[model samples]
Target: MEDINLDDAIKLIKDDMHSYELLHDKFLSYINRDPDLKNLVHSYKSRFKDLDHLKSKIERKNHEDSMLPEDEQKGPITQDNIQERITDICGIRILHLYIGQFEAIHKALMKYVNSNELALFEPPKAYTWDPEYSKTFEALGVSPKLKESFYTSVHYVFKPRADSNITCEVQVRTLFEEVWGEIDHTFNYPEPSKSKVIQEQLKVLARVVGAGTRLSDSIFELNSLQDAE
Candidate 1:
């Protein structure tokens, strides 16, 4: 690929910005109306990356890799590979009520991938910190990555079809976990909290969030059993 500076990359993205917006809308519309997915989705939010943030991200990523050997470095984002490199121009977070609903939700998302209604940019994996929580997912055949962060979510990158390079990142998590994430982000952003006490509190809070999810799961299970009775 020919060398392209930041300005050129930005121009390239700007010129084709309309098409990205169209792709974003196409995905947003699908999630809103897709019967299998919509019912399970408690709520969702979608966005295209802000241009200013994208610029910063590109610059930071390039700089981070600048020290590596020439052959190993991914040079600036050029027009040729912008869409492929910046996969999450359109990102959606799907929050469900309880852990019990995840299997159905994952299956609904996979149905499209299996039928070619959507294309997988990558295989799905669950990012988890708790061994017990991870075991639940592992039992279902979806591998869990043992990440150190409190972050937990199942990620799927889907393209509209085989022909389109445009991608949407979907993050699925329980509403309980979503609340904990927002609360924990306060101590983590910009830098981790300087206070060791705060760090310990956050860990305790994370465990509380996990317990809440388990309790939610149990309540839902009881309701289902009562219905069967």
Candidate 2:
């Protein structure tokens, strides 16, 4: 990684910025055109990763790898591998109003993929689904979940078409989860929060967010029962 020139890498990213912008617009159009997605989401947003942030991320990853034991270390990031290694240079986020909507939106996405309405660069993956959340979704019979850190989102790596080399990451999360994520990212990201009080509070807030989601789901379930009655 040290052997690779940072200037050249930044140039590569800057030169490709226009292409990413086009890809972002293309994705936004698709989301808007899909009636199910348009009606399900509370908000939609997208961005191209800043050049400095990209460089810092590469440096951070390499630094962390250096600190690991030899057998555990992931390989370094070099200019040659940067484009292939970093997947989220272009990101799109879809925010839903409630937890219950995730399953429906997820199902819509699967149908889109199966029908070839969208082209995926790789298999879809969900991030930050702890055991409790997994059990909750499993009971709903929506989708299988993976346990990870405190965050929560469904991510898809895809291109305008399979033959296109450029890829963008699409993320889906509830508005409640997005609020918590923004707070966590502001205070604890790039580096974890140093204050134990703040750290503990964030964890507490995560639980609160979880409960809020459950409550929202229960309210919908109750309304459905009443409608049926």
Candidate 3:
């Protein structure tokens, strides 16, 4: 595949950045209005990708592709398909307190997908490395993919229509996982961490995050059962 001229690609993205911001606001409003989603989410955050971060990501992807053998490398990002290739230009993150709550939150979001209000740009991904947490996702019909960094979250990609260039990615995770992710992001962004000691501690923190979610779920469940009696 041919390389994209950095200047041309950046110019093209800069031109379309406003539309992405509009799309971000539109999706954010939808979540705020949806009754089921409003109750299920403890809080939410949204942002369109920053222009400089997009430029850096393009450079990084192209560079990583160059290091791989010809047949193994993914094609370089091009101006023709940069917006389509980078699906998370606008992103919304849904955070809740308990793992038990994810199934309801996911189901509520899927309503938009099922109704085609938002076209499914990619299949949903559940990210985690814990075997027990993996089963939690699988039981709700989402397949778990092992995240080597042990960063845990569930991601969904949606676009306005089946072929729309404007897209948004929604990430669902517990408050506990959110804390772990922020720490991982600090170490691994722009460059991977060379510090093995830091990596090991992050892995340990991931387990603690999972346990926190489970413990929160258990407390809610027992309290509900008692109130019903």
Candidate that scores best on lDDT: 3
Lowest summed lDDT across 10 adjacent residues in model 1 is found at 1-10
Candidate 3's C-alpha lDDT? 0.84
Poorly placed runs, candidate 2 (over 4 Å): 1-3, 129-132, 136-149
Greater-lDDT candidate between 1 and 3: 3
Q: By lDDT, rank the candidates, best first.
A: 3, 1, 2
lDDT by residue (tens digit), candidate 3, 1-229: 3556777877877887777777677778777898887888899888777877778788789888888999997778888878778888788898998888888888887777789877777788899887887887888778899978988999988887787787788899989999999899999987879999999999999989888888898999999999999
Candidate 1 regions off by >4 Å?
1-4, 66-80, 139-141, 190-196
Q: Write the per-residue lDDT of candidate 1 for residues 2-67, one digit (tens) a residue.
A: 333676676777777777677667767767888877888899887877877777777666666676
Order the numbered candidates by TM-score, best leading. Answer: 3, 2, 1
Would you estimate the TM-scores of all the predictions? 0.84, 0.86, 0.93
The local distance difference test score of each candidate is 0.79, 0.76, 0.84
- The 10-residue segment of model 2 with minimum total lDDT is 140-149
Better of 1 and 2 by lDDT: 1
Can you write out model 2's per-residue Cα lDDT over 90-154, one digit (the tens) per residue? Answer: 99999987777877787777676677756777766555545666765666443545533367777
What TM-score, to 2 decimals, does candidate 2 have? 0.86
* TM-score-superior candidate, 1 or 2: 2
